[model samples]
Target: MASLSLPQVDFRAAAAEGAADARLREAVRNNTLRKQEGREARWTELPDAQALRELAARIKQHTLENLDYYLRQLVDAVRRNGGVVHFAADAEQARQIVLEIAQQTGCRRIIKSKSMATEEIELTPHLERAGLDVVETDLGEFIIQVSHDRPSHLVAPIIHKDRRSIARVFSEYFHAPYNDDPPALTQQARLFLRDKFRRSEMGITGGNFLVAQTGQVCVVENEGNARQSLTTPRVLVSLVGIEKLVPRMSDLAVMVKLLARSSTGQIMTVYTNIFGSPRQNGERDGPQEFHLILLDNGRSQILGDPEYREVLRCIRCGACLNVCPVFRSIGGHAYNSVYPGPIGALLSPLMFGLERYKDLPQATSLCGACGEACPVKIDIPRLLISLRRDMVNRRLSGKLERLIYRLWAWGLQSRFLYRVIGALQRWDLRRRADADGWIARLPKLAAGWTAQRDMPAAARRSFHNIWKDRH
Candidate 1:
């Protein structure tokens, strides 16, 4: 088994660094805003977008409620179709299972599609350590692989990167003249990967949804890389989270309707591959051996808790990330988790613990954009608030922070203290104002406010004072 231990995450530092990068901020903001606009445009084409989202949420909720039963059914169905199913208790177990399969099948070369689940388990390095040649076939993933960079977005892996950066990477890798053309870069990669695909003996993928009724793994993609990953190799392995189950194929219809629209604003992805089992007697293509590894990895603990279980309904479409004010300011890597943005804020704390990822919940502005943007309606802001309350209950908050909040609460409950605090706050703010009336700096606790934007000085007269004078 490979080591899964991770060092302490400094989310605040990473977020601050990302926020300070003007070029990175511009790239991420422009891409996400365009996707958001496309989503809104696509939503208008639907008869009842909200109703469809509700239906999709209900389907996921139903599957989660009866997960055990669905799991049994899914396993049996896969077996009936000549496919194998394996249960992994965590990331270590999941990696071990794939390694064992690789060893048994005598596979040396592997091709992998873009799967966040595989990334979540950190499978690639373990395989590389085992001396197997593994290549990321997805164009974005390929860039990330060669450049030694992590994905910054769910759908668009290299959202933080510009054409210049990519061209530099490609030029260095291919040892060719600098070319920033999109088609040329894509051709350079495609020509390089075409040979790898031909030689790869095994394929790896992540599922968007698992249809329990027919034991099919449905993977959606704009590019055809996932299709090749499924059909080009003799042995196929799919690593999917346990929470990805959908009870019926009809339910998959409801999910598919919202998935692409919510993700990149397409009516449907260019390729939506739904497959089960290995190739049958007359099949010329497709894998001869298939294995599905269902990963738990702290999900069972999350499922057992009612307050946070609804988050399991997420389809990972990343609509929330696109519309997130905080994510727009600071890209995905700042979250310091395989998942990022509003969803990552909830998941990291819930799956890992509040102690390691306490700053994640505070990353959001609680603007409710994530909740409204979610296709599955996960209510991310509500979950974030719940996590914050949990943090306070667990004494994860600092002593001074708790004291300040307590004092603030106490002052709010008393009229005299409220007025006194308000007067003092106004005076202090006014005193800090520069000649132009913009406060460029703030005192201790509120200093971060002026770090990016200047604050305006409070008005000399209050509304209450004006009303009293008029009366």
Candidate 2:
């Protein structure tokens, strides 16, 4: 019943705002730390966790390399299984395709499962403008819709919201007494959404994995809302990115084993829906019409570049988010895309232009936590560095920033200049130190470094000087 449109994202501004919010930071820190711990515990249950991650990565890479062949095979298979396939070159086309389907079906009441693809295209607002009543069925998504707020995390959408804020939102939305209890909030949403599920004429979802061998769209979720989206409507549509394809059912099996564990540390989600075709003659109930929209907004560009194609291996498990220090502190809203965290830092720039999301590449600390936590073993930090390099090469970085780096390079080229600059920097920094020998503030370009953290005063003697004295 409600929708959200993301405004122009200023990563620096948003990151500062999120960092300044103690409550938001605490909420994100607690949730992500818990999930990170859970993921570590779950991975230990495996005989060879790293090996499995490598195998999964290989499967994805192989599929991406031969994506055309698998996609063709998938299209043929889906057609044979009584499913229609649509290709969208971009976001506008994707929205238009779904609108056409709704128009053709003469459908009005629509219920959507939690879908990042849908969020990426801002589908709900488009559908609403077409005079359709669309409801978000997933609990977190439902809350997001009700509050007109964007999701801050892939798996845990409301990680930025604490119980008290959620209680106020629920109270205001339902016009009922405040209740912060998790079960009560869930029950409240369930009761409201059940009616929408029963009466919906069309259902929309996003595919977690599209199995090329069997033409089945695999969707795993902790809640049964996705299950309801599949069964309750006369028409069902799954809008998925083209990169979601896995070569075979066996590959899908391997992915399933890691997805839930990486996301929430569960061995398996409560619902795992694998459906492609419309209901058969003998079937009691299922969608009468099925449509799969393959979206390629910017994936083809990333896939074509061998240097960064590994970024596509991301499965949206939110494992990287849980382990990323920047995301844990500043939260997902700072990334300014439907995708967030370490993966988003790489993706938002690649999918969107480098200039549009230039700041995203600089968001990471390059701590390698995301890379280690990634279930598919995607080299996240490497790819982020790649994106950062691209930003510089493409002249997306500020002129002053580029000039500063050039000067730094020039200084480093000569030993004398390097020593001179190092000594001057140390002397200046030490001069700025307070009585406690901590530099609490800095001027100009170095101001941001001291904004949130104090720099330790430099030693009186340089390492070179100390070495000369010893000699």
Off by over 4 Å in 1: 1-6, 431-438, 469-471
Candidate 1 per-residue lDDT over residues 110-187, each given as its tens digit: 999999889888888888988999999999999999898988888889999999999999999999999999999999
- lDDT at position 66, candidate 1: 94
Clash pairs, model 2 backbone: none
Model 2 scores a C-alpha lDDT of: 0.90
* lDDT by residue (tens digit), candidate 2, 429-458: 889999888999999788978987999998
Worst 10 residues of 1 by lDDT: 1-10
TM-score of each: 0.96, 0.96
lDDT of each: 0.91, 0.90
How close is each model in CA RMSD to the real structure?
Answer: 2.0, 2.6
